[model samples]
Target: MDGEPVDARWGSARVRGRRLRTVRAHAFAAAGLLLAGCASMPDSGEIRAVQASQGVDSQVRVFGVPPADKATPAEIVDGFLEAMTSDDPQLETARKYLTPAAAKSWKPSSAVTVLSSGLSRVAVRGEKDPEGPRWKVTGKKLATVDEHSAYQPQTGAREYEEQLQLVQDEDKQWRISTPPSGLVLSESDFQRIYMPVNKYYFAGGTLVADPVYVRQRTDPDSRMDPTTQTVQSLLAGPSRWLAPVVESSFPTGTELRTGTKSLSYDGQNTLRVPLNDKVGNIAQPQCKKMATQLLYTVKDLTGSRLDQVELLRSSDDKTSSLCSVTSVSADAIANRPKIPEFQYFVDNEKRLVRMKLDVSSEDQQTRTEPVPGPLATVPVFKVSSAAVSHDERRAAVVSEDGHGLYVVSLVGGGPMPAQVPIGRGGKAETLTAPSWDASGDLWVADRDPQHPGLWRVPGGTGTPERVQVAGLDNRRIVSLKASADGARIALLLEQDANSRILYIGRVERPDAKGDVSAVSVRELRPAAPQMADVTAMSWAPRGRLLVVGREKGGVQQARYMLADGSMVAASLPGATGLSEVAVAAAEDESKPKPVVAYSEDGIVWLPPGAQWRTVAAGGRSPVYPG
Candidate 1:
């Protein structure tokens, strides 16, 4: 029977006398008989054993209950708030707690206010209203999901307060007269109802992943499932934070064909998307790009394999063929990072060294060897920290004194190249570790007290240009990591002894005919505001950061977080006491490389589903290819 209310009038009816009591007893007897007829325990059967659930039940679904008769004003307000968190497809049950006019005007999908816990509802003692009683609902806001499905987290726990008025209906039953416009849910409820999905867009020639949230099932207001809703959000362009750096291939007004409500895969494991006439006349190349974006965005939504995505355009009330892209063709358009052959680090001898990746067995003691280039044969200064290029052909090394930066070749033998002068003259411990973006450009930060700034070297071989960081109020960038897509950068900054913050900024450049000198960092938003201290971080696959830090009044640990500032269900199982950590930026994330870190035990490697094991006894600054 799916366990829903068959009839609720029995609870709302007003009746009296012994005859009504007898009717209630008869109704209860009839229900017992109906349930008994379905199944009965075999009292004399032989005993048998069955397996019990091994873990907590995750598939439990919540249903809303109707209000009791003669409910008080506070009860009405509290019931409405509880009903908002239930998974009602159309939210009709939640509307039952509201007045007719208020129900009609309330739009739950307008926005979502997420709190750390359930809201507190209390009666206003001295309020005087002619037609209703007043109650207050308040919470500490943690985040908000906008109408566009973008998840934005707030730094501080801001106060959120609203008033709910209760009035009597024609039958004199209490109901909420005024209701909030959007859904106010606790953090646990929000996680259960919504899921995180990525939409693809172009940043210059590379594809970037923009993370957003969508309802887990059919949306209450839109009536569209998660796949269709994600595609619609993709056509609406990137989020406001990412709109400045990325562009969508879809046309300005392009949308799903009219009256489309759901999207599914065909027998060939292919998805065919129908678009409106606005994109009917696009070229094959442009159409392919659009299909590629859709293929990546919705590939993981369903259990079935998504091998290809074909676009169908409407013309004269008839659908015609547009271009299509397969999984193979999409890779050419998306510039994902290449798999690295080895993980690099600074050894006890202060030289750049490497060890083979994907170690197949526990008994396999892979030997560590020096790199094949000048950094191995003709070293000039002691190496403190380093970053390998995405292609694994070159490495950027910082001097042990932390005042010089040099780019060294790892594949070809040559003399050690001259240090890239970043103009941080004569200052000790001024230069941070160097990082390489997917476009082959190098980035570094100078924390010199006199000239604190960020510098980018064009092509890793050109003059360094100091980039201006917006919204950095008297803070110095201490460490930095540019994303493999070259569209975003993560920075660890400090303002004083007590102020340490981690921020992710959008990398912007002017359209002055490919002028690389005009590049600057803009819109530095907090990436890990929940933590009080962030010691180390590196760019991980799928546009995430592998962070090492601790929350306020907590101990240090390592965890992974999305670049959009949303939490995920991922963290190092027992990786503690880590001073630094690194993750490989590979294209295929299904089989990730081992996490490399440096701790009190020296260089440690954490293979998937295994405890951390020491590799080198005296190594510091372990790193992977960007």
Candidate 2:
């Protein structure tokens, strides 16, 4: 029926010669028959009219226990329905009661289109009664759909020719429509209903997350009753929606907290305290709720759909909680958490809104054998990021899984050094660096493929456009970070053979027409002559570069240049963990000293002097807020 049949054998097997000549007359006859059949098609329009008339037929009569003349409408309807479907031993129904044809209603082939969802239409129709009286019915439906979709009335809807309907027949004493064998199975009872939709379906829909629970309604031939939708709306209706959760602090259901400490970000003051009541399926619910709101805001404010969020405790670098907007990343083949995966966040007011976790696990049983007697092994981690607002008012940390990003208050003063994604994981390909602007609108750390520029997110709530440079040598970039003044953007990119390169660039904001551009500012490389693959770098507020490397000497300060590289100055004693140290220009001019941070001997250390004074028995990355 979908198409026509072809010759069983093409080319040679097609009819020819005597066969073709003999078949022309038969084919002609068949065509004539087909044409005749078409010409003789019945008047379905008239049939439909008759069927509609039957809905209120005056000729039909019924003999039942109830007296027709005295029976009430309800009683008559009940009796007729009984007779039409009579299946008892005392009563039997026959097939003669049904009309030969029935009116068929369906969606209109040519219907109105919907330009938008907000359109509304009102209609009032009146029908004349048998006594020259008229009855009117008023109704309304979405008018916008007239332009976009095709909808229809119920299948059994009919324009009645006879005036008497839904009332008792004087003879039959019943008001029931019947099928063949007098069965009361007509389509009149099956009325169409409305579509069921909730407020979240319209307001909370995540355009990028694209959760599977959401979908468009396209039912030219709907299988469900339309009234159900109206009923649902009546029940739940609309309201101001609830805000999303952004931050949280909790322990897993498997473990309970005997001691939970509320700490701050001070390198020396932040510590863990035990809580006795924290147990299975039992977390700090208030904290978790706050975390959820913070995390969702991270998405709205930052304008990036993330994979995971985490919450970490600084005491032992444990993951206290975790969250992710999406279950996993797009390229994730199985279950692998990528690095730079967790994001740290902040709000417009410079408050820590979101946090990331920093947790790790290693098999101490096997590794212990490699060390000497009384040897012990433990895992460690660094909470990578927490997203924030443009003004840096609020901040949050994301877990390695990207599930939930927890909100933290850099100002309200809650637990300090709180992380989001708590579990341990490695680096990944997409690291959306969170940024805050003067207005509190969020921005992202994005890569630039063209001209090796920095992709800084413009302030607003919309799709992020990539900012580019005119000329440079770079490709396949993945990470980014912007300066405090919004002047510079630092980028970490993937190079040949799993290597990485860092580049700095300046930004040019949009004009009255709204456009942006980036320019390379400068480059940071090994200041040491040997320069054995520097791992990372940080810019001090005092305008100095904190570079990391595995050089032979300690306090290897030097003037770095792209053309010639760095020159080592001197070496100090007992500085073995050079690779684990991160340096920053010393603050407090009265006590100006290079802030040296490193981890060793079950303790994180941050020394104040250029000679490594070991200020904190356990601390790392002692950030001095600007």
Best by lDDT: 1
lDDT of 2 by residue, 450-519 (tens): 2223333334343345455433345544444444334344444455544445444433444311434332
| Cand. 2 Cα-lDDT | 0.28
**Error at 215, model 1, angstroms:** 0.9
Each model's total of backbone clashes: 0, 120
Off by over 4 Å in 1: 1-58, 125-128, 315-318, 361-366, 379-381, 423-428, 495-499, 512-517, 580-591
Error of 1 at 296 (Å): 1.1
Q: What is the alpha-carbon lDDT of model 1 when measured against the actual structure?
A: 0.76
TM-score per candidate, chains pooled? 0.86, 0.28
CA lDDT, candidate 2, residue 284: 49
Model 2 residue 560 CA deviation (Å) reads 7.9
lDDT of 1 by residue, 1-626 (tens): 12121221111122111001222334565564221110011122221211111111224344455666887565566567767866666787688899999889989998999876556655653224564577777777888888778888876558988888777899988888778889987776677678888999988778898988888878887789989999989998888888878888999999999988899999998999999998978988888889989998999777889999999998777887798999888878876677678888888888888888855655423667787888877444478889899899999998887888999888888788899988466747888888888889999999888989999998899998889899888798889988888889999998578656789998987742254558888888788877788888887767778888778898777878877776754888665667644333343364687788888877778877778877777777777776
- Evaluated at residue 458, the lDDT of candidate 1 is 87
* Whole-model lDDT values for every prediction: 0.76, 0.28
lDDT of 1 at 572: 84
